[model samples]
Structure formats: C-alpha cells, structure tokens
Target chain A: MAMERHERFSLPKVWKPRNVGEAWSLKRSFGSDAEYVAGGTLLRTWWEGEVAERPAHLIDIRSLPLLAGIRIAEEGGTGIGACTTLAEIRRSCGLAAEYPALPEAVLQIGAYSIRNVGTIGGNVASGIGDALPALLVYDAELLWFDGSEERIAISEWLERPEDCRRDRGKLLMQVRLPDRANAVETPTGGGNAPFSVYRKVGRREAFTPSVATVAISAGRTEDGRLERVRIAAGGGAAVPHRLYAAESLLEGKTPDPDLLPLIHEAVEETFRPKGDVFAGEEYRKRTAANLVAAELWKLSAGRQGKE
Target chain B: MIDNRTELAPAQSRLTLRVNGAACEIAAPPSTRLLQVIREFIGLTGTKRSCEIGRCGACMVLVDGEPVNACLAMAYQVQGAEITTIEGIASGTELHPVQRAFLEEGGFQCGYCTPGMVLSVKALLDRSPDPSDEEVEEALSGNLCRCTGYGGIRRAVRRAIELGR
Candidate 1:
C-alpha cells in the first residue's frame, strides 16, 4: 500500500462547477485528464496510492445543485441526488421504515465519519460498493447525464457498467427507488408489506469490509406462496450482482423447510465470489449461501406467523 | 460562466474557514488534507495523525459540528465551514464535560487515541443526549484503542452523559 502523506502528490487544479451542464462541459473539455469528485472518500484513497490514475484537473462536483437533494415524489417514491451523503440516507427515517435494506446497507459501509462525507452516487459509481447489492434488490433506477439525462435500471448497469462510461463525460445524476406501496401486499388483509432484509458478514463486528453480503425483498402470496422474490448478493471478493438463477427458481414456490436448502444450494452455485486477503473464495461462497438460506428462512417464518 | 479551459491552472488558492470560533485564512494547494492544514499550517497538534487512510479515526475533527475524518477532507472542501479540533474542545480553564468525564473515569493510558475517542463521544452526545451502551460502541466504532480494552472508555462515555446532565 502506498502510504505517502497527503501532500506528496503534486496537487491538481481543482474546479468547483456550479451546475451539472457546466460540470459535464468541463469534463468534456478536460477529456481524460479531469475526474469528477464528490465526497472523495474512495477516489482520494485510491489516488494516494496511485491506484486511481491521477488527473490533472480535479472537478469538484460538491457545489453543483444538480446533485444535492433528496426529494420524494408525490407517489411515495424517492429521487435521491447523487451527492446525497451516506449519512443522510442512513438516518432517513422514512427510507428506513419503508425500504429497510437501503439504510441497513448504508449503515455498514464504513465508520460514522466516512458516512458523514461519502455520497451514495460515489458508492454506486465505485463499481463494487456495498450499497449496490441492496439497490439491485430494490430494483433501483439510476439517472445518467452525458449531454442529456437518461434513466437506466441498476440491474442492467451491473451487467455492463462500462456501458455508462461510453460518453467519457457521463455523470450519475441520481438514484430513484420506486414506491414500495406498488409491491403486492398480502392478499388475506394481513396488512403486512413485503419483507426486505440485508445481512452482511464481515471480518469483524464493525468498520470492516464485508466478507459476504445478501439482500432480499420478497413476500408470500394469498396462498402462502412466495412470489415477486428478488435476491442479490455481493461483497468481499465478489462482484456485486443480482442472483437471477436463484430468483427464477424460487419464484412462485411454496415456502418450506426443504425450499430454503434448495435456494441455498442454488445461490452457492450462482454466486461466484473472488478471494482476497480477508477471506478465501470458498469461504465467501459458503457465507453467501448460508446468508441466503437464513434470511429466507426468517422471512418465511415471519410470513407464516402473520398468516 | 462555463470556462472550458482544460489546461493545468494554479493549484494553490486562498481558503477561508472558521476554526473553533475564529475566522482564519490560508493559502494552500486544493489537495491539502484538513489534517495537514490543522497541524502544519495552523500549528495545532492536538489532533493526532495515525493511519492517513480513512480506516482509523485518529485524525477525526468536527466539521460543521459533525465528526469527520480530517485526513480524508481537503482544505478546499471545508471553505466557510466551522471546524472543531481537539484543541477547541475545552473552554479555557474549564474542561468540556466529555474531557472531565474522561479524566475522572480514567479513559486513557497511552493517551494517543483519547482525542479521537473524546471527539466521537462529543459528536454522539450532541446528537443523542443519552445514548445506550450499544449506541456508545457504535459511535466510537471508528476510534480504536490498543490499551484499556475499551472498558475505561465505555465508562467515560457513560460518565460524560451524566456529567452533561
């Protein structure tokens, strides 16, 4: 690890753009020599060690109004600006109560101080961030801007993240989480919403990168059958991704003691986690499978009690 | 005014910020970490620098009344913001409640991690006046102590709550 003090790197000229268009235009003008920075928790760390190639121009996007608000749509969905701090998202009472996985995931990213400065947009664009799995399970959509604004599903972006960078000057505008009320509720008037759970097993209790993380948003149908089940897993050495194979197999299936084991096995097969210094590849895959089973089992048990 | 100039311009600029309760101005490169500015430029050494990376909270300081890793923050980013370093914690001869609590509860043996721990506790109590033991642990999660096994530290946090009352 490169451990030079902060001043070692010959500092780049910093540009504080006032708006999105201006920021984008600056990025275009600087071409490959300029990099957009929001919180700088991740980028600065990489830049210190020369992991992230140093740019001649550091475009500070912190001042841009285009990336600074968390607005709730009239329909109960949320439109979170890219620069909204992780601390804000972790403490959002409405988001916690409605979409539990988001806050749960955000809370596990780093320590309190890092959360205070780290932004959700920076997390998403980090490519292998802890929040990506939870966002995938929530079916979150991202707003992107090159010259014009466009919205794309997070799941699609996960498959080909490089596609978003085609423009070379693309900016992540915001993340949109659809209204949870739209998710089909229990048919028997149980008044319970879909169960969403996020579990992250790390090397230690807190402030450690996850060894394996799992997020599930699922619920039972009128006949006590599981449907609309979405599962995503990432963390540790693994590339954050949606578990499509497991999701397809579990859909419309009745929750039972046997079913969880099957889902666990399927996840083990689907989840291809890479190994790092913290854990081995086999350990990550096993932990991912175990978390998938345990979370599903708990969710299913809670549903049975409500029924 | 979109100045599409891509060339490398002047890296150093005038940065003005409120430190503790005083307004201050300094010229520095935009990449200068707030930790470096506070220690080297302002000459206040209370905030210790350990792991320059974000992993350790030894360089924690309050920016806008919230606990932040000074090492991770650039001087240019904190322009016009209120910053509180360890040196700013006490009010003259009268020690802050958290500081008094740490002394009374014997919160330090080595004293290297004390400043960061105290700042974390201050940030927590400012937000949640009476935090539970779990909340205390969560609040101080970033600040690590090699000695004391955190028993004394935990007591200090609880005592700080009472002292505040």
Candidate 2:
C-alpha cells in the first residue's frame, strides 16, 4: 500500500489548543498572524504557502470540545457547535424536519465532499454565505465568547459582520435556534408547521454560488390570514438581509393573489443586490424578487392545502 | 522512516497518521496542506493535485471515512485520522468493486478525474448501498470529468452499487 515518498518543504506553524480558553489566549497573543480554523474550506484558500499575506499561525480549533456537535435544548431549541460540518447538518433528520430551509440551503453549497469538511460556523462567518438567509428566517442567534460570553441575534451579527471577526478576540461559540416547540405547530387557521422555503438560483443548476437566494417562514391565523411572516434574501455574493418591507406586506393579511406582486415589489425596494461578473444588479434584483415571490406562493399553497 | 508512536510537542508537532492502512509519521509544518503531505511526504501520487483551491475535487481523500477535499485540509487535521486514498481502496492486488465497475462502465476517457470519482463512489456506496439517481449525481457533483461527458460515470455509479450489493 506504500508508494515512493517525495521531498517535503516547511509550511507555516499551526497551533492546536485543547479548549476554548486556551484557543482564545492564543488568538489574543498571535493577533493578525494567528487565525482560528475549523474546516478551513474558506480560510485555506486565502493563506496558501509562500503567500505574502499568509497567516503565520494556523490554529486548529476542530479538536476543541467547546466547538463540536449539535445539541438540542431540553426546552425545545437547537444549538449547533461552531465546528459542526455542513454535511452533518444535511444528514440530520431532526434539523431537517424542524428547519427544512437550513438543510436545503446547505445541500446546495459546493458539493458532498466540500460539505463534509465545511463547518456551519465557517459558512455563516463567510459573510455572504448561502445559509445566512435561511438562518435569518428561522430567527437563529449567534453565540460567541469575546473576553466574556455573549449571544446576539443572527440578524444583528449579519448586519455588522466585521465587528464579530475573531481577530478582535471575539470567537464564535455556537448558533442557537429559538425554542419553537411551544410555538403552536398548527396555527388556528391553516398549515401543519411554520411553512418555510429556501430557493437559490445560481449561474449553474446546483453546487454553485447563488446569483439570488431567498428564504421565508409563514403561518396562517384561524381566520385564514397571514398571522406571522418572515422573509429574508441575499446569497448571490451580495449582502444577505431580511426583507422587513416584504414581511410587513403579508403579516396579518389574508392570502390574496395580488400579494405576490406586492411581495416582489417590496423585495426590489428593500434590497440592492451587488452586481458581479456572473450577474448584473438588475438581473439579481429581478431574480431575488422572483425567488421571494415563489416562496410566498409556496407558503400560501401549504395554507390552501390545509384549508 | 520516523516512528509513528514518537510523540512530538503540542505546539511544533510532527503528524502521526494512518495513511492507506500504514502507520506513518512525518514532519508536517502547521500550514502544510493534506494534499501536499499525501502526494509529497507520503508519496501517494494517486491523489492528483490540481487547483490548490478547494473548488476542485482533483485532490480528494477520505479522512476517517468521510470524503473531503485534500487541498482544504491541513496536514495536522489528519493526525489521528485513518486516511484513505485511491491507492488504499483496493485490497491485495485486486481493484475495489468501484474501480471494476468504472472499468466495466467506461467511466473515464482521460483518467485524470477517475481516482477522485472512484473514491467518491466508494464513499457514497459505503453510506447508501442503493443510492437514487439524484443522490448519485449529488455525491459525484464535486468530481468533474471533462472527457467522457459523465454518462459513463453515471452508469459506473449504478454498476458499482449493483456490484457492491
């Protein structure tokens, strides 16, 4: 099974810390040269051998027990450790049932192998990650430890990403989904669960960066009105965001065919998708609006089916 | 050859791993990529190195039974991991069933992508014995084959499933 060995060269130094506290201390000491790496899917691309800006110290945080595994809160929420791989999330049947959009978003990024090593924390930390929109719709929260432990809503973290960078000794601990168990699965009027849909239209059919992506969660009231609506978009290498205008358009209103056009218009008004070589601003704006409309239609369809 | 059990310091450390069922120890710098260690230090040329970026699946290997892009993994990440490469899939002078199926199905023309594709098929079959067409497509999506168009590879995946069962 052995093959003839080739010559080797000296690569940069890596530090392996056993726990979060030790890792944090290392981060504080190394400053810019030290970067914490879990899966290294995104970070490795930047700090290759002999690169001028290469990270001097690569901190392997995958082994730390503090940043591993998925834990379900006894009170009915889900907490995913920072090192939890996207493949783990994709294969999790429980998470899939509770938050379908999360698994759906994960499966569309890269492919099976990349997903295997790509951590959820890494994905969210990427800033323009595909999973952010879905997480926003699910009301996910980001848990991190700076000098002290702090937790913030994922929406807030997404708004100011640079502030959360680990370079400043602020390390991401885990992502928490609020306890949705007590929340009525079947609302008075329609839908079995909070119907959610995440759609990403990219340059290619699958396993490519999104040109436009949108995720939505909605439930109807006893009178067949839109009781609660949450809509978020932006995965196209553009700014990921929640569409408060679009969500406001549907909340507490009955599902009407005209609402589709209103939702699309609201999305266009809210988001200005940054254009790239693959797609221009107008095209991405149109696609984002279309995806948002499609999800609204899907949630409305689910309510109709229940009715 | 370095002793596999010789423990290095926790900070500046040597990598001790099982590569292709062999307990191997080698000097690994902190930032050394697994792809480099596999092809260079370990001398397993079966895992091709193309596009050092993680986007390309040319440098694919199985670490502890999970398929991951070797280009993206650090050498130390595989320190206690059971590493499997294209060379390790077969046992004692026999091609693994996936390789045989690829041969039967004409899964490749240029053969550059075959090693990664075959290992990916091995990982898929290890998990799902009877994978659906979409599942097969999803599993092999990371592996790009420009030569044979992928009709042959699709057939190879189906054939491998049958042969394994």
Candidate 3:
C-alpha cells in the first residue's frame, strides 16, 4: 500500500480498508489526498483524460461489508450496495423486471465489460452518469456514511454533486430503490400499469457520453389521466435534473397521441441541459424532448391495444 | 512535464494471482493495471494494450467467469479472483470454439483486437448458449475492431453460437 515511485506516472497507493470505520479514519487522515474508489472506472477515465489528478491514496471501499451486494429488504424494495457493478445489477432479472428503466439505462452506460467494472455507485457519484435520469424517475435514495449515516434522495444530491462529494468525503454506501411491485393500486387492468423509458442518444452506438439522455415514468388513471408522472433529462456535461414543468404538464392529462406535440414542447422548454462541441445545447434539449414524447406515446398505443 | 520512465520504484507486494488455472506471483504497486500484470508479470502478451483507458476492449479478460476491461482493473484488486486471458482460452493444441469461429468467419484483419473479440464472444456464449441479436450486439459494443468493421466479427459470433449449439 506504500508504493511511492513515479516511473511513468504517479500511481496512487491503494488502501484496502476492512470496515466503514477504518475507511472513514483513512479519509479523515489523508483528507483530499485520499479517494474512495469502488469501480474506479470514472476515476481512471478522468485521469486518462488529464482532467483530474490521481489521488495519493485510493481507499478501495468495494470490499466493505456495508457496500457489497444487492439485497432485497424486508419491505421488498431493492437495496443495492453502492459498490455493486452495473453488470451485476443487469444480471438480476428480478430487479430489472421491477424497474426496467434502471436496467435499460445500464445497457446504455457502457458495453458489457465496462459495465462489469463500473459500479452503480460510481455512476451516481459522478452525477453526470447516464444512469442519473433513470435513477431520478425511480426516486432512488442514496445512503451515505459520513462519521454517522445519512440517507439523501438522488434528486437532492444531483443538484450539487461537487458540494455533496466534498462535504461527505464521497462516502456513498447504498442505493435503495423503493418496492414498486405492488405499487399499481390504480382503478383497473393493464391500462393502469406504469410505463417507463430510459433513452440515451449518443454520438455513436455506444461508449460515448450521451447527446441527450432522458427517462420518464408514469401511471395512467382508469379514466385516462396520467398520474405520478416523472420526467428527467441529462447527458454530456449537463447536470441531470427533473423536468417538473414538463411533468406537471403531462400530469392529469390523457395519453393522447395529439398531446405528444405539447409534451414535447414542454420538455424542450424545461430541459436546459448543457451540450459539448459535438452537439449543441438546442439539439440535446430537442433530442431529450423527442425521446420522452415518443416513448410516452406508447402509453396511448398501449391503451388502444388494451381496449 | 515530468519524465516518468527514468528511475524504477520499489515493488509493493508479491501477490498470488490465480490466472488461467495456474498460480502466478506478481510484485507491483496496488495501482498497477491488470493489463500490465497479465502482460509483464504473468508473461501473457495475448491481451493487447491499445488505449490504457478502459474504452477499447483490447485488454479484456474474464475475472471469475465474467468479462471485464483489464486496463480499468488494478492487478492487486483481483489478486485472488480467477483471471482468464486470451492465452489461457486454448486447450493447448486446440483453439477455443470462439477462436475457431473467428478464423472460419474472418473475424479480424489486422488481428490486434482478435484476442479481446474472441474472449468477449466466449464470455457471452459461456453465460448464454442462445443469445439474442441485441444481447450479442451489447456484449460486443465495447470492443472496437478498426480493421474488420465488425461484419466478420458478427458472423464469427453467430458461427460460434452455432458451434456451441
């Protein structure tokens, strides 16, 4: 763990802490010099991109008992250890069926091998991760350990990842997804079933950061009104945020194909996502809006198929 | 602007890595990439080193029966885990079915990305005997074959599935 020789570049000293207390103490002592790494996919890429420095001490917290595997809580909600890799999450059929948006977003993150090493926690911690919008729609809760423990909603943390990362020392422990298995208590049949979509439009088919990533989930009333509508958009350097205005507009409205244009307009107006040189700001907004509008129209189609 | 290839540093720990059904002892810092560990320490150069970043799947290997980008993982991190590389895939004289499929279908031209492509296909087939087109596409999406343009690789994957069946 004490290797400090720079042959080509400075490789960080890796510390394998056994427990949360040890991990915290090491972070406390090393301060900014130390970083808690799970998958290390994001950190490694950032280093290769020369955007960030390799920390002196990388506290490997992937093996910590508190942050290890996927668990089904007593209440039936899925509690995924922050250290769990995206690939591992994808393998869980139960979890995928429970929330397709999450697994769907996982598929769009990176290819299979990258997903194998990239942890969901690392994705969430990065904030700009493509998975953020999908997690947002699910109302994912992040459990963090900072001296003590605190549970914060993903929505709150996404607002200021840098500030949260700085203040909490990047100690994200678990992501708890609420049990939505029996959540559909609406008036009737398959029409009331929640429809969710996670779409990532990238420069290429894979690997690149998304041009505009969007996730939207909604349940419809028996009388045809949309309810519990959640809309989120993100990609590239843009901060992932909820489209509350678009959500409200879509809410209490029937899933008519004619409403697609208005919903699209509302999303385009609300999603103020940043864009890089490859894609302009307007393109990302429109792409996200189009994806959301198009995907939601499936509900209208689904209604027809049911009737 | 610092030169890193000047002087060597002291090796950190002697790790017993279980690679390809054999025990190989490697001594390096905790931060050494699995790519270096496999190539330099384990002496297996079959795993190509293109982009040191995890973007290119040239350095893919199976860790405990699951495919992962070797460049992204630290050697010490997977010390005890069972690591399988391209060199280990063949049964001595005979090549693995994935490798055979690549040859039969002309999966590669320059052959730089062949090892990784083969290993990725093997991983997929091992997990799923019958994978859908989407699954195959997703599994191979990380690997970049600049020469073959993936047409041959696609055929190779299909052929490999047939071979497995």
Report the C-alpha lDDT of model 1 over B75-136, residue by residue, as the tens digit: 77898899999889898989999999999999999898888888999999999999987788
Off by over 4 Å in 3: A1-9, A166-168, A184-189, B1-12
Is 2 or 3 the stronger prediction by TM-score?
A: 3
10 residues in a row with least lDDT, candidate 2 chain A? A1-10
Candidate 3 or 2, higher DockQ: 2
If scored against the real structure, what TM-score would every candidate get?
0.93, 0.91, 0.92
* Runs off by more than 4 Å, candidate 1: A1-9, A74-76, A164-167, A182-191, B1-3, B6-12
Best by DockQ: 1
Q: Sort the predicted structures by lDDT, highest score first.
A: 1, 3, 2
DockQ of each: 0.55, 0.42, 0.38
* Highest TM-score scorer: 1
Query: Model 3: per-residue lDDT, tens digit, B39-146?
Result: 877788999898878788998999998888898898667867899999898888998999999999999899999898888889999989899999899888889988
Ranking 1 against 3 by TM-score, winner: 1
User: What are the RMSD figures for all models against the true structure?
Assistant: 3.0, 5.1, 5.3
Grade the docking of candidate 3. Answer: acceptable
TM-score of 2: 0.91
Candidate 3 local lDDT, A82-151, one digit each (tens): 8899988888776666777888898888888988889998888877889889989988899988777888
